[model samples]
Each structure stands twice: as structure tokens, then as C-alpha cells.
Target: MRAVAVTAFGEEPQLMDVPQPEAGPGEVLVRMAVAGLNPVDWRIADGMLKDAGPQSFPMVLGTDGAGEVVAVGTGVRRFTVGDAVFGRFWRPAKGGGSYADLAVAGEKDVAQAPRSVTYATSAAVPTAGTSAYNLIEETRAGEGKRVLVVGATGGVGTFATQLAAGRGAEVLATARTTKADLMRNLGSAATVDHTAGPVAEQVLAAHPEGVDILIDLVSGPEEFGAMTRAVRDGGTAVSTTGAADADALTEQNLRGFNFHNRPSPQLLEILAGQLDAGRLTVLVGSEVALEEAPEALQLSRTGRARGKTVIAL
Candidate 1:
């Protein structure tokens, strides 16, 4: 099997021949049609999870993908050969991932891909969508709440903006001036030009009264703390990038936490249903073949990608 993997943590990923993975108990073997790229893909390849999770050399590096099930391990009854499925695929303990011709996933993180969605779209859903959903769930954002999404043009930010809007929150999204229309189309009530200066100042100017919830995606601890000032008294602030100052925010009587997403099949199904019902959209900015993924990943690391990038097999 052909896979893109790093020989060791912090090593460059290369196209190399590796042994194909097979289904184990409660797992399904998938013939990947497409793989989705996320920041974590490169982060893990660079050994971001060295202490937090298992690590292996020659480790494949994709976490989300869509494909056909070619075989199922014993006790797996929900899927069989030829079933179209998609979901999170990386398991550091296993060391294998979806950046290959074939991958394996446990039943808990796998779900049937609806026919209404393309393999490319399905491949893009798991990580960003689930993370967005989890963030919204934790905040309990909804009607009348004023919500702000920083870094609103990336994959997870795009989904978070839409989901926050769908939940009836008045959404303010941060993006470069060029993406103003895109943010508006995604249901943001207002768009802040993050590149101009401090986003908190821009947002504060618009909503004189602080927002009910703040979701910051691209800030460090200091910047995130400064941004939390825009959260109204008793409001909530969460950072998906592990930048929240929880103790300080708590002392100030505001809720704050760093978010970590836990993906599951049920969440994927709910997101897929929204896509099917025309309530959700997955914005894929580009598609490349497996051989071109390395370059695409490099380009994406610039942190300016406007939408999801999928690697078509």
C-alpha cells in the first residue's frame, strides 16, 4: 500500500510503501476514496502528541476520510463490504491513519456516508464539524445570545459560525476584509477585519455591550485573555487552540475553558443530517490527488486557507 508518513516525529512525510492495515475486532477496513487535511494532521506528524498519546515512526497522518468498507472485523454488524462510510480515522495507538490507500477505524467513530454527499464532502466533515459542534454544545449558545467566532474563515471556524447562527445566536465572525461576503453568507451577523488590528477592539466597537459567548480559534493565552474582556459579565469564553486562561477568567466571574474535541459516530450522523437537510454546508476550497497532498499541506500551514482541502485518492 502507498502511504504518506513520517519516518519519525518531526520528520518530513514522504510517499512510501507500507504494509496495508486490516480490520481487527469491532473495526472496519476501508478503501479510502478521499482524505481530509487538518492542522492536527501536520501537528501530529511533527510529534504534537508525543506525550499525550501513543506515537510510532512511519506513522500515517490524516484524521478524517471517506471511503468504501471492504471488510469488517468480527462482531461488526453495522457495516459490511461495499458500504460507503466516513469519519475520523487516526488512532495514535494504532499508528496507522487515513493518508493511505487503505485504513481501519473502530465502529464507534465510523458512520455511513449519505448518498446525498460526495466522498470529498464526506471526507471533510469529521474533525472540523465535530469540533464546531462540540464547541457550540459546551457553550450552550442559542437564541438571543451574542456569539463571536475568531478566525472565521478556516474550516472549523466556518462551521462554528454557521452552527452558532443556526442556533439563533447573533454571530460576529472575524476574517480578512476580502472574506467579508463569505462570512456574511455563512450567516454571521457581522464581520470583523482581524488583519487590520486587534479583533477585540473591532468587535467591541460594534457591540458596545459585550457578547454572550466568545470562541477564539487563533490566539495565544495573552491574546485570548485580552479578548475575554469582550465577554459580558457571567458570559462564556472558550478557545479551541488551548489558549484560555481558565483561573483568571473564573476569578473574573466568567466561564472559560480550552476545548478538546471528542469525535463519535452519532455526532457525525447529526452533522450529515444537517448537510442533507440543507441546513449545513461544507466549504471545500480545493482538491488534490494523493501525490499532491504534501504540497497542499505546506500551503495550508500558512494559516490563510479559506476552506477545507481534501485529498482525492
Candidate 2:
């Protein structure tokens, strides 16, 4: 089987002929149709998470994927051969990932793919979908709440905007002018042109009382702190990039925390249900063949991505 992988951490990923992987106890082996590219995939390859856990060489570099199950291991009763599935497939310790023709994942991280969409779309949902759902739940975005989504055109941002709006929150999404219409179409009540000026200024100028919640997906610590001004006292601010100063925000009479997503099979199933009901959609900006993954990975580092990128296997 052919896969895109690095011989070692910090090495560039390349298309190589590697041995196929099989499911282990409590795992499932999937013949991948598509693999999703995420920012953390590149970061892991760069050794930023070297201390996170043990790893194996010739490590495959994809986190999410959609495909057909080819085999199941002992104790895996929920899935069978030929079942269509989508979810997390990154097992660095086993030198396995979704970039290959076949990948392995713990059963708990795999779930039935949304029947209403193609494999390409389902492949893009796991991480972004789960993150958005968990964020909305944590902040209780709903009727009467005003939620602002920073980086609202990116993968997780796109989902977050829709989910927040679907729950009846008035969504304020930050995007470039080019994506203003798209964001509104995705349910943003208003759009903030982040490129024009400070987003906090624009948001506050329109919503004087401030939003009930802030979901900061792209800012650094200083910028996140500065943006928290858009959240009213007693409101909440959540940062996905570890940019939140919890104590400092609390001192300002606002609730703040660095968000950590907890993805689960149950969440994936709910997202799939949303897709099936036509209440959710996946936005795939680019799709590359497995062989082109190397170049695609390089382009991801440019930080200009507006939507999800998928690798067709």
C-alpha cells in the first residue's frame, strides 16, 4: 500500500510504498476513501508534540478520514466489514493514520458516516464538527445569546458559525469581505471584516452591549485578551489556541478558558444525524490525490486556508 509519511518527526512527508495495517483488539481497519488535513497534522510532523506520547517511524500524517471498513478486531461489535465509517484515524504509536489506502482507529473514535453526504464531505467533519459542537455546548449558545466566531471561514469556524446559528444564537462571524456572503449564508447574522481593522472595534460598534460569548479560533494570547473586550461582563470567552488568560478574564468579571475539544463517537453520530437531517453541511475547499499530499501539507502552512482540505485516497 502507498502512503504519505515521514521517516522521522520533523521530516517532510512523502508518498511511499508502505506495509498495510490491520486492526488490533478494540480497533477497526478501514480502507480509506478520503483523509482530512488539519493544522495539527503539520505541527505533529514538525515535532511540536514530540512529548505528547510514544510514536513509530514511517508515521502516517492524517487525523480524520471516511472510508469502508475492511476488518474489525476482537471486542469490536459495533462495526463489521463493509460498514461505511468516518472519524479520527491518527494512531502515531502504530505508524497508522488516514493518509494511506488503509488505516486503523480505535473503535471509540470511529462512527457511521453521514449517509446524506459523500465520503469527501464526511472525511472533513470529525475534528471540526466535534469541536464546534463541544464549544457551543460549553458556552450554551442559543436563543437570546450573541456569539462571535473569530476565523469564521476556516474549518472549525465554518461549523461553529452554523451550529451556533442553528441553535438560535445571533452569530457574528469574522471573515474577509470575499467571504462575507458565504458566512451569512452559513447563518451569521452579521459579518466582521477582520482584514479591514480590529474585529473587536467593529463588533462593539455594532453590538454595543457586547456578545454573550466569544469563540476565538485564530488569535494569540495578546490579541485574544484584546478581543475579550467584545464580551460583556458575565459573558464567556473561549480560545481554541490556548490563548485565554483565565484568571485575568475572571478578574475583568468575564468567564474565560482555553478550550480543549473532546471528540467522541457519540458526538460524531450526532453530527452525522445533523447532516442526515440537512441541518449541517461540510465545506471542503480543496481535495488532492494521495500523492500530492506533500505539497498540500506545505500549502497548509501558509495560513490562508478558508475551508477544509481533503486528500482523496
Candidate 3:
């Protein structure tokens, strides 16, 4: 199998022929058509998960993908040969991932692909889509609520903006002027120009009362704290980057927590439904071949990619 992988942590990724993986117990072997590139994919290659667990060499990059099930291991019953699916395929300890000709995913991590979207789009959904959906559900952004989605031009932010707006929330997204129209089309009620000045200042200047919910996707502790100033008393603030200070927020009469994505087959099904029904749009900003994964990782590192990047297998 041809895969893009790293021989060691912090090493550059390269395309090489590797041993084909098989479906073990509770797994499903997928002939991947496309793989989604997330920041974590490169982070893992850079040793982000080193403290979490053991890792294997030649670790293939990527977690999310869309493909057809070619075989199923024992105990897997929901899918069979020829069924199309999409979801997580990350297993670092085993040197397995989605950026390959064939990948093995836990049966519980995958679901049927959306019929209305292409394989590239479906490949882009598992990580970013699930994170966005979970964030909106946790914040309960809906009618009468004001939600602020920082880094709203990114993949997760794009979906979060739409999901919050679909529920009637007044969504305020932080984006550059060039992306204002795109943000608005994704259901943002207002677009804050982050490049103009401080994001919190601009937001507070517009909504003096402050927003009810805050979703910070691209801030560190310092900037995330500043953003929370735009959250009203008794409002909720969440960070996907582990930047939330729960104790400090509690003292200020605000709810705060760090959000880590927990995507399930069920959640994937729900997201697929949204896509199939045209309520959600998967933004595939760039597409690359499997061999170009190293360049894609470099692009992700520069933080220049606008939306999701999909790798065709």
C-alpha cells in the first residue's frame, strides 16, 4: 500500500510503500478514496501525542477519511463489503491511519457517507464536522442567544457558524474582510474583523451587552482570556485549544471548559444527514494527491489553508 508517513516524531512525512493493514477484531478495512487533513494529523507526526501513549514507526498520517468497506473483522456487524463509510482511522500504536490506499478503522468510529456529497467532502467531515456539532450542542446556541465563534473562517468554525445560525442564534464570527461574505453565507449574523484590531474590542464595541456563548478555536490562554471579556455574566465560554481557565471564569460568574472532540458513528450519521439534506456544506478549500501530503502538512503548519484539505488516495 502507498502511504504518506513519518519514520519518527518531528520528521518530515513522505510517500512510501508500506505493508497493507488488515481488519482485526472490531475493525473494518476500508479502500480509502480520500483522506482529510487536520492540524492534529501533522501534530501527531511532530510528537503531540508522545506523552499520551506508545507509537509505531512509519506512522501514517491523518485520521478522517471516506471510502468503501472491503472487509470486516469479527464482531463488526453494522457494515459489510461494498458499504461506503466515513470517519476516524487513526491508530498510532499500530502505525495505521487514513492517508493510505487501505486503512483500518474501528467499527464504532465510522458511519455511512453522505449520499449528496463527493468522497472528498465526506472525507473532510469526520474531525471538523464532529467538533463543530459538539461545540454547538454543548453551548446550546439557539434562538435569543448570541454566540461568538472565533476563527470562524476555519473548517470547524465554518460548520459551527452554520449550526449555531440554523438554531436561530445570532452568530458573530471573527474573520478577515476578504472572508466576510463567505462567513455571512455560512449563517453568521455579523463578521468581526480580527485583522483590523483586537477581536474582543471589536466585538464588545458592537454588542455592548456581550454575547451569550463563546467558541474559541484558535486562541492561546492569553488571547482566549481576552475573548471571554465579550461574554456576558452567566454566559458560557469554551475553547478547543485547552485555553479555558475554568476557575477564573467561575469566579466571574461564567461557565467555561475546554472542548475535546468525541466523534461517534451516531454523530457521523447526524452530520451526514445534515449534508444529505443540504442544511450543511462541507467546505473543501484544497485538494491534494497522497504524495503531496507533506506539502499539505507544511501548509497546515503555516496556518494558511482556508478550509479543509482533502487528500485523494
Candidate 4:
């Protein structure tokens, strides 16, 4: 099987002929049709998780993918051979990933791919979609609430805005001037161009009081603190990027925390429903072949991506 892999931490990724993976007990072997690129792919390649735990060398470089199940291991009953599926495929500590022709995923992490979207688009959903879902869940956002999504034009931001808006929240999204229309089309009630002025000033001017839920898709520790001030006292601020401070959260009576995205069968099912009903849009900014995955990862790491980049297998 052909795969893009990193032979060592911080080394450039390369295309190599590798052994095809086989399903183990409780796992499923998928013949990948497309693989989704995320920021983490490059982070891992650059040795970001080296101290976090052990990693398998010559690590494959992806976490999100869509493919057809070719074989199932013992105890796997949710799917059969030839079932179309999409989900996250990164090992927790070991570095094996999805940027390959074949990947082994636990049955628990795989779900039926949406019938409405193509394999490339479906491949882009799992990691970013799941993270956006987790951020929404953490904020407990819903009907009639004012939800503000900072940095709302990136991968997770795009999905977060749509999900919040779909759930009946009035979404206020932040983007560059060029992406303002795109945000509005995605269901944002209003758009703030972060490049126009300071995000804090623009947010407060739009909503005199405050927002019920604030989701920061891109923020560091200092910026996160400033954004938290825009959340109503009793409201919550959630970050997918681990930028919130716990002590400050306690002082303000505002719930603030970071969340790690967990891919679940239930969440994937809900996302599939939205996609099938034409309520959710899967945005793929670019598509490349498996051999081009290394360059794609480099671009993703720069944090300038307008939407998900997918690799066609």
C-alpha cells in the first residue's frame, strides 16, 4: 500500500510503499477513498506530541478519513464488508495515522458516511466536525441564545458556526472581510471582520450586553482571557485549543474550559443526519492526491486554511 509517513519526528514526510494494515479484534480494515488533513498532522510530524507519549515511527500523517470497510475483526457487528464509513483514525500515543491506502480503526470510532456528501467531503468531517460538536456541547448552547464564534472561517470554526445556528442560537461569527459573506451564508446572524478592528471591541459593539456562549476557535492564553470577558456572567466560554484559564473562570462565574474532541457513534449519527437533510455543509477548500499529503500538511500547519483539505486516494 502507498502511504505518506514521517520517518522521524520533525522530519519531512515522504511517500512510501508500506505494508497494508489488517483488522485486529474489535477493529475494522478500511480501503481508504479519501483522507482529511488537519493541523495535528503537521504538529505530530514536527514532534509536538513527542513528550506527551510514545509514538510509532514512520507514522502515517492523517486522523480523519472516509472509506469502505473491506474486512471486520471479531466482535465487530455494527458494519460489514463494503459498508461506506468515515471517522477519526489516529492512535492515541502511537503515531500511526490515516494518510494511507488502508487503515485500521476501532469499530467504536467508525460511522456510516453521509449519503449526501462525496467521499472527499465526508473525509473532512470527522476530526473538525467532532471538535466543533464537542465545543457546542461544552457551551450548552441552544434556542434563543446569542452565540459568538471567534475565528469562524477556519475548519472547526465553519462547522461550529453552522451547528450553533442550526440548534436555534443566533450566531455571531468573526472572520476576515473576504470571508464575511461566507459566514453569513453559513447562518451567522452577523459577521465581524477581525481584521477591521480588535475582536473584543467589534463583538461588544454588535451586542451591547454580552453573548450567552463564546467559542474561541483560535486564541492564545491572553486573547482567550479577553474574549471571556465578552461572555455573560452566567454564560460559558469554550475553547477547542486549550487556551482558557481555570482560575479566571472561577472568578467570573463564567464556565470556561478547553475540550478534547471525542468521536462517538452518536455524534457521527447526528452529523450524518444534518448532512443528509441538507442542513450541514461540508466545505473542502482543496483536494490533493495521496502523494501530495506532505505539502498539504505543511499548509494546514500554517493556520491559514479557509476550509478542510482532503486527499483523494
Candidate 5:
């Protein structure tokens, strides 16, 4: 099997021939049709989890993919051979991952892919979509609330905008001028030009009263703090990048937390169903082949990919 992998931390990812992985107890072997690229792929390659868990050398990259089940390990009952599935496939403490022709995942990590979208689009859903879903849950956003989604043009931001809008929250999305239309179409009531000037001033000029919830996707501690200024008193501010300041938020009597995605088979199924029912959309900006994954991964790390990038097998 050919996969994009790194032989050691901080090494460049490469297309290499590796041994095929098989289903173990409670695992399902999938013949991968497509894999989704996320920023964490490069981060993991750079040793982001070196102290968090065990790791195998020559580790394959990627975490989300869509494919058909080729086989199932003993005691797995949720899926059988030939079932079409999609979900996060990274196993940090073990070896192997989704960036390959074949991958293995626990039965609890995958769900059937929706028929409305292609495998490549399905591949883009697991990580970003699930993160967006969880963020919305944490916000508890709904009618009459005003939500600001920073980095609205990125993968999770795109879905977060749609989900928040669908919940009847007035959404303000931050993006470059080129992506303002895309953000509006995803249900933002307004779009702020983050590249032109300070986003907080632009947002305040438009709303004046501050927003009910702030979802920051691309900021570090300092910038995330600046963004939090736009959140109304007693409101919530969340960052998926671990950039939220807990003490600062508490001092201000506001709720704030860094969000880390915890994916489940149930959430994947719900998100897939929403896409299939035409209630949610997954924007795939580009598709690359397996051999092109290394360059694609590099582009993702630069944070310049306009939207989700998928690797089709």
C-alpha cells in the first residue's frame, strides 16, 4: 500500500510503499476511496502528540476518510464487509492512519456514508463536520442569538456557519473579501474583512451590542483575546485551536473554553444524514491523488487552502 507518511517527527511527509494494515479485534478494515487532509496531519508529523501517547515510526498521515469495508475483525457487529463507511481513522497510540489505500478503524469510530455526496466529499466531513457540530453544541446557540465565526472560510468554519445559521442564530463570519460571498451563502448575516483591519472594530461597527457567542478558529492567545472583546458580557467564547484564555474569561464573568473534537459514530451518522437530506453542505475546494498528498498536506499547513482538500484514491 502506498501512503503519505513520515519516518520521524519534523520530517517531510512522503509517498511511500508500506505494509497493508488488517483488521484486529473490534476493528474494521476499509478499502479507502478518499481521505481528507486537516492541519493536524502536519502537526502530528511534527510531533504534536509525542508526549500525549505512543507513536509508531514511519507513521501514516491523516485521520478522516470514506470507503467500503473490506473485512471486519472478530466481535465487530456494527458493520460488515462491503458496507460503505466514513469517519476519523487515526489511532495515535498504534500505527497506521487514513492517508492510504487501506485503513483500519474501531467499529465505534465510523458510520455509513450518505448517498447524496461523493466519497471525496464524505471524506471531508468526519473531522471538520464533527468539530463544527460539537462547537455548536457547546455554544447552545439558537434563535435571537448573534454568533461570530472567525476563520469562516476554512473547513470547520464553513460548517459552523451553516449549523449556527440553521439554528436561527444571526451569524457574522470573518473572511477575506474573496470569500465573503461564500460565507454569506452559508448563512452568515454579515461578513467582516479580517484582512483589511481589526476584526473587532468591524464587527462592533456592525452590531454595536456585541455578539452572543464567539467561535474563534484561527487565532492564537493574543489575537483570540482581542476577538473575545466582541463577545457580550456573560456570553461565551470558544476556540478550537486551544487559544482561549480561561482565567481572562472568568475574570470578565464570561464563559470560555478551548474545544477539542471528540468524534463518535452517532455524530457522524447525524451529520451524514443532514448532508444527505440537503440540510447541510460540505465544501470541498480541491481533490488530489495519493501521490499529491505530500504537497497538499504542505499547502494545508500554510493555512491557505480555500476549503477542504481531499485525497482520492
Candidate 6:
């Protein structure tokens, strides 16, 4: 089996022939069709998790993937051979990952892939979509609310915008000039150009009373403070990237928190239903072969990618 792995933290990933993984108890072996690249992939490669815990050297480097089940392990009854599934494959402790041609995931984390979308698109949905769902749920944004999504052009941001709008909130999103139309097409009622001027000023000009919910996908300390000011009193502010200040959150009448995405079988089923109903869209900007994962990972880390990039096996 061919896999791209990092022999050491901060080392370049190398494509090598490795032994194929087998299904353990309550796990299912999947013949991977595509792998999704996220910002976390590059962070892990750069040794971001070094102090947090131990990692297996020569560790495979991917979390989200879509493929067909080749075998099911003991105690697994939900899936069988030939069933199509997608989800987070790598467990932090196990070190096994979806970057390989074959990988194993616990039956609990896997869900049937949407029939409406290709495997490449389905591969892009699990992590990002689940993150978006959690963000929306945390904020409690719904009907009649004015929700703003900052950094609305990236993978999770795009899904956040659509899901917020679909929930009956008036969605306001930010993107570069090139992606303004794309953002609007995805259900944003208003779009701000982040490259043009200050994001805080642009958002305030559109909604003078402040928004009911502000979701910041990309922000630093200063940028986050400015965006937090755009949230109305009693409203919520959520950050997916670690950009919120606890002191400021207490001073102002704002609730602030960050999100770490967790995979849920129920959430995956809901997202799959949305995709099948043509209510949710997975925007895939590029598709590369498994051999090109290193390049794709770099592109995702640069924050310049317009949409999700999938690694087709």
C-alpha cells in the first residue's frame, strides 16, 4: 500500500510503500477513494501537537476520507463490504490515518457518503461540515437573527454561511472581491471585501445595530476584538481559529468561545441528508492525486485557497 507519512515532526512527508492497515475490533477497513486536506494537517506536520501528546513517527497524515468498506471487524454490524462511507479515520492515539490507500476507522465515526456528490466532494465535508454545525449550534443562531461569517471563503466558512442561512438567519459573509459572487450564491445576503478595508467597519456599515451572531473563522487578537464589537449585546461570538480573549469577553456583554470539531454520526447523517436534498453544497477548489498531498497540504496552510482541496486516491 502507498502512503504519505512524516518520519518525524516538522519533516517533509514522503510517499512510501507501507503495510496496509487491517480492521480491528469495532473497526471497518476502507479502500480510500479520496482524502480531504485541512489546516490541521500542516499544523501537525509542523510539530504543533508535539507538547500535547505522543505521536507515532512515520505516522500517516490525514483525518477525513471517503471510500468503500472492504472489511468489517468483530462487533461491527452497521457496515459491511461494498458499503460507501466517510468520516475522520485517524485516532489521536492510534496514529493510523486516511492518507494511505487503505485505512481503518471505528464504526461509530463512519457514515454513509452522500449519493448526490462525488467521493472527492464527500471527502471534503466531514470535518469542515461538522465544525460548521458545532459553531452554529454553540451560537444558537436561527430564525430572524442577523449572523455574520468572517473569513467566509475557506472550507469551514463556506459551510457555515450556508448552514446559517438555511436555518433562517440573515447571513452576512466576508470574502475577497473575486469570491463575492460565490459567497452570495452560497446564501449570504451581504458580502464584505476583507482585502479592501477594515472588516469591522464594513460589517458595521451594513448592520448599524450590530449582528445577532458573529462567527470568526480567521482572526488574530486585534482582529478578533474588533469583530467582537460587532456583536449586539446579549449576542454570541464564536471563533474557530484560536482568536478570542477571555478578559475582553467578560468586560463586554458578549459570549465568546472557540471550537474544536468533533465527529458525530448524527451530524454526518444530517449533512448527508442536506447534501442529498440539494440544500448543502461542498465547494471543492482543486483535486490532486494522493502523491500530491504534500503540495495540497501546503496550499491549504497558506490561507490562500478559495475552497476545499481533495486528494483523490
In order, what lDDT does every prediction score?
Answer: 0.88, 0.92, 0.93, 0.86, 0.91, 0.87
Taking all chains together, the TM-score of candidate 3 against the true structure is 0.98
Kindly report which residue pairs in candidate 1 clash with one another: none
The worst-scoring run of ten residues by lDDT in candidate 6 lies at: 88-97
Tens-place lDDT per residue, model 1, 63-143, is 899999999999998998999999988766666689899999998888989679799999998999999999999999789
Quote each prediction's TM-score: 0.97, 0.98, 0.98, 0.95, 0.98, 0.96
Error at 259, model 5, angstroms? 0.5
lDDT of 1: 0.88
- Per-residue error for 223 in candidate 2, Å, reads 0.9
Residue 239 lDDT in candidate 3: 98
lDDT of 4 by residue, 1-313 (tens): 8999988888899999766777888889899999999887888788888887777777888888999999999999999999999998876344477999899888999899999889998999988898888888778777889998997898898999998888889998998878888998999999888778778778787677889988998888889899877788888887777898888887999877887877798898888888999988888999998888888777876788868999998
Q: Would you give me the overall lDDT of model 3?
A: 0.93
Per-prediction RMSD in angstroms? 1.1, 0.9, 0.9, 1.6, 0.9, 1.3
The residue pairs found clashing in candidate 4 are 56-95
Tens-digit lDDT track of model 2 for 65-132: 99999999999989999999999998888895889999999999989999889999999999999999
Question: Candidate 3: misplaced stretches above 4 Å?
Answer: none
Query: Between 1 and 4, whose TM-score is larger?
Result: 1
State in Å the error of residue 52, model 4: 5.0
Which tens-of-lDDT digit does each residue in 5-24 have in candidate 3?
98988888999988888899
